[model samples]
Target: MPRTQDFDTAEVVGRARDLFWDKGFEATSIPDLERVTGLNRSSLYNAFTSKRGLFDAAVHDYLDRVVRPRLRILTDEPTRPDAAVRYYRSLAGALASLPDETPGRGCLLLNSAAGFAAHDDTQRSVVDAYQRELSGALTHALRAHDPDASTATLAHRTRLLTSLSVSALLLSRVNRDEAVAVANTAVEQLEEWRRT
Candidate 1:
């Protein structure tokens, strides 16, 4: 008979997600996962298939736990004129909350894209999907705010907000103030558009 999963897979994945979020995919060794998760190498492999498999699971966890919640600010309140601003501020707050010791611990998807995603098709696809989701949310917000906006205008704003959001996230890790500033500027620009 096959052995049942005696441990809580969610709990294991949560711990693994934190470690991967902190250390990136390539830098996190099996021993590191073992140490953090208290699972033996055999157990880890049996449970997740491989380190990359575990990392993929952790990336999905990050998306569900960290990324989706924030992205909701865009989708949930697409009609809100300040939805984009609120979204950016929330991101800034999350960035600010990170410990001072770990600067540049940016978005897991973005960081993974820069590192593991380049060489790993699975990682790259996950990152690409997240990016597409974000872009769609932005497009939704633009259309909500201005239902009659010209297609060209809507497309322009969507691209602009999507780019700004990615840039803000990357910058947040290195410099919180700069990231916040970028967000604030984008907010102001959006607000000005509303006023005019």
Candidate 2:
């Protein structure tokens, strides 16, 4: 008979996610995961098959737990431009609240794109999918701002806004004030677009 797994997979994955988020995929090692997840090497291999597999699982869990929830806040009220503003503001707030010690722990998806995307097709695909989803959410919110706006215009603005949001996250590490300013600019632009 196959041996039953001994540890709680969810707990293990959560720990792995934190480790990956803190250190990133390229820097995080199998031993680090084993230590953080409280699993022996053999058990870790048995459960995840490989270090890459564990990282993949961790990334998926992080997106589901952290990223998707924030995106939901924007898309939830699809007809309110203020909802989009709230979404960006909330993201800025969350980044500002992170402990100073974790300075570069920006968006996990963005970090993955910078570090592992080119190295791994899977990572690249995940990042692209995330960008597309965020752009789609912003597009929906923008459409609500002006029912008469063309789909092409809304999509273009959404892509621009989403790109700005990611750039703000990166800049937050060096200058949080600038990061918040960038987000505010996006909000201001969206509001102006609504007026026109």
Candidate 3:
């Protein structure tokens, strides 16, 4: 007979997500996961199959709980300029709210992508999907501002805005203040784009 899980899967994955976010995938070992998730190696393997499987699940959980909501403002709000401003402002507010001692883990998906091998298709697919979601949101916002924008123009704007978004997150890991400044500049740039 199969053993039943005694612990809450969501709670376990949530803690694991935080651990993976705080420490990059390569740096986070099986022992670290065990400590953080409060599960023995046998239990973890029984639940997740392997360390790679747990990381994948954690990434999915992070995307569902953390990332998608943050990007929802862009998707739901119709006004392009305000939505754009809010997107960056919200990011700044979140970064500022983090305790100074906490390491700015930036985006967990991106952090994992940085260290993953090129041949790692499973992880690569997750990262690609994340980027696509972000790009789609940016494109929607840009199209709202200029309803008649050509496909090429919208694509360019999407790339530009997405770059800024990722850059702000990565920069926050190093310096929250600098990240805020970058976000402000991005907001200003978006406003300028709307003006002309």
Candidate 4:
């Protein structure tokens, strides 16, 4: 039988995820991973196959740990009509709470969209799938908010809200105020729908 591993895979992924979140993939190096995950290069290669593999694992960890929790409010049973709004507010709080050092870290996948996703087919697909997932969750929440909205109207609103959310996440790593504004715009759009 093969030898049993020593470290906790989830813990290792989480540590590597934070390092990648702070520094983009290209910027993060083998030594960096070793430093963050406490796994030397050979061990890292053995466990993850390659740096890209580790990054992929980190990305999935981010989705399960960070993004999904936020999206759960939108997709969970008995979703509140104001869930989309609450999500944006919660997102704003998350952005505000980021330490000064990495205030512009934003969403990790969104960062990939700007960096690797733009040029790498695999990365692009990952970002695209993430967008679709987010859209679906937001659509579910929007439906709860306006049960009578026409299908076309709901579709349009979902697209707009999704765009705003993507913009907010991408901007979070650069300008916190603007990121909050973009996220709030989604909330404002929903409020407008409620009024009219």
Cα RMSD of all models vs. native, in order, equals 1.7, 1.7, 1.6, 1.3
TM-score against native, each model: 0.92, 0.92, 0.93, 0.95
Cα RMSD for predicted model 3: 1.6
Task: Write the residue-wise lDDT of candidate 4 on 1-196 in tens digits.
Answer: 8767899999999999999988989899999999989889988988999999999999999999998988999998988888888988898887777666666777888888878778999989988999999999999999999999999999999999899988888888878888888887878888999999
Q: Which segments of model 2 are wrong by more than 4 Å?
A: none
Write candidate 2's Cα lDDT for 63-114 as tens digits: 8998888788768843565778778778767766766655656777788888
What is candidate 1's CA lDDT for residue 88? 67
After superposition, candidate 1 runs with Cα above 4 Å error: none
Ranking by lDDT: 4, 3, 1, 2
Best-fitting candidate, measured by lDDT?
A: 4
Question: What is the C-alpha lDDT profile of model 3 across 7-71, one tens digit per residue?
Answer: 99999999999988888788999999999889999999999999888988898899999998888
Task: Go through the candidates in order and give each one's C-alpha lDDT.
Answer: 0.83, 0.82, 0.84, 0.89
Worst 10 residues of 4 by lDDT: 95-104
Give per-residue lDDT, candidate 2, residue 79. 57
Q: Pick the candidate with the highest TM-score.
A: 4
**Cα RMSD for predicted model 1:** 1.7
Task: Output the worst ten-in-a-row residue range by lDDT, candidate 1.
Answer: 77-86
Model 3: residue 47 alpha-carbon error in angstroms: 0.5
Candidate 4 ranges with C-alpha deviation above 4 Å: none
